[model samples]
Target: MLKIVYPICCGIDVHKNFVVATIATTDRENITTYRTKRFSTFTKDLRALALWLSNNQCVHICIESTGKYWIPIHNILEPSCQITLAHPKYVKAIRGKKTDKKDSIWIADLHKHGLVPGSFIPPADIREIRDLLRYRSKLVSFASSEKNRVQNSLTVSNIMLSSVVSDTFGKSALAILSHLLKHPDDQDFDFRPLLHGSMLKKQNDIALAIDGTINDIQAVKITLCLSHMDDIKRSYVARGTAF
Candidate 1:
């Protein structure tokens, strides 16, 4: 027989709208009693559940980490209970039936036998920092995608901007492209005026690179990509500042 690590423990099957909880208790005679309850995933209901658990003298609680749904519940019960954030795969129903109640009971039984392995849950402040970092990472990825789109647009127009400049999205390249986009039909366009710093040395090459057939459609797409990149950059800076 498996030893009971926790003689009295509760298991919670978390969902988006509700949670199913099962409380199990084992006596000196090795007799076990199980009681189940359902609670809505609301603040009031969660508080009631906490009260019920407290009344039963149950402090050990095992909860399945189901997406973002478990965070709020964990927040509500963290102070009162010894919470174990278990992975759902580790608490799967290996026998009889598969229902919310059954899942909760199974988890409680597993916790009783010390079979539930808890997942790592960082402190609240660390979790907030992690969320901000993840958001910033996504923004950075989107900005890179937009940069690639801009480069691809330039390539499609037979523009050798990227081949000439180390970064096609650099300030010098953008200034040249802006001039070319504005005066698409100016065959005798003087690009020396847009060349700045070391770019002045490559005046002839920059002129040759800008000489491309960028039609109205390609120009519009390129403008949109640049605009989106600007917006992403602004957001990235703002998020970094927020951190």
Candidate 2:
């Protein structure tokens, strides 16, 4: 015989705009009663749902993971309810007969017998850190892609800066590139002033590498790529500070 783990519990079917909730109350005689309600996904409606659950003395709640739709509901109910966040497969309803109310009821039935397993959710602080780190990672990836675009622009324009310097964006290379962009028509400008440290020894090679022509369009593309890379770097630093 199945054991009645929670004498009274609620199950929720989360959606983007709304949710359906059903409360299951089981009696000692093995009888179960259900009361289902629909609520909007807005904060006010979710608060009312929490209040309704509190009033019915139902603290154990089960809900299926449905994209980001379940996040707001979980946030609103986290303070007052013992929420069981189950994978959708664990609480799936019968095919061809699935309705919001029916799904909620099915979840409630599974939860009532302690048949539902909750997914592992880190604490609030850890979740916040995780989100920030993930966003920073994306920023780093964007910056790398922008750097690649800049390198491609240089390569197509016959700018062999990458071949002469270990880092094309290094101080000396950028100084030479900046001068080239500012004085696009003056190819004979001396490279000695831009050459620094060990780069001074490779002055001849560096000058030869940058001797190629860079059209107006290629120059503009390189400029835009550098600008975007700078923006991504700033965002990455800001996100790290937020962490």
Q: Could you say which candidate leads in TM-score?
A: 2
After best superposition, candidate 1 residue 237: deviation in angstroms? 3.4
- Looking at model 2, residue 5 earns an lDDT score of 99
Model 1 lDDT at residue 128: 88
On a 0 to 100 scale, what is the lDDT of residue 40 in model 2? 99
Any runs in candidate 1 off by more than 4 Å, and if so which?
Answer: none
Residue-level lDDT tens digits of model 1 in 1-243:
989899999999999999999999999877889999999999999999999999999999999999989988998999999999998899988876589998999999999999988998888889888998888788889888988888888888889888778878778888878876888887567777666678778877777777778899989988998899889878757766774
Per-candidate Cα lDDT values, in order, are: 0.88, 0.91
Global local distance difference test of model 1: 0.88
User: For residues 116-188, what per-residue lDDT tens digits would candidate 2 score against the true structure?
Assistant: 9899888999999899788878878888898899899889989999999999999999898888888889899
In lDDT terms, how accurate is model 2?
0.91
Off by over 4 Å in 2: 236-240
How far does residue 56 in candidate 1 sit from its true spot (Å)? 1.6
Could you tell me which residue pairs clash in candidate 2?
A: none
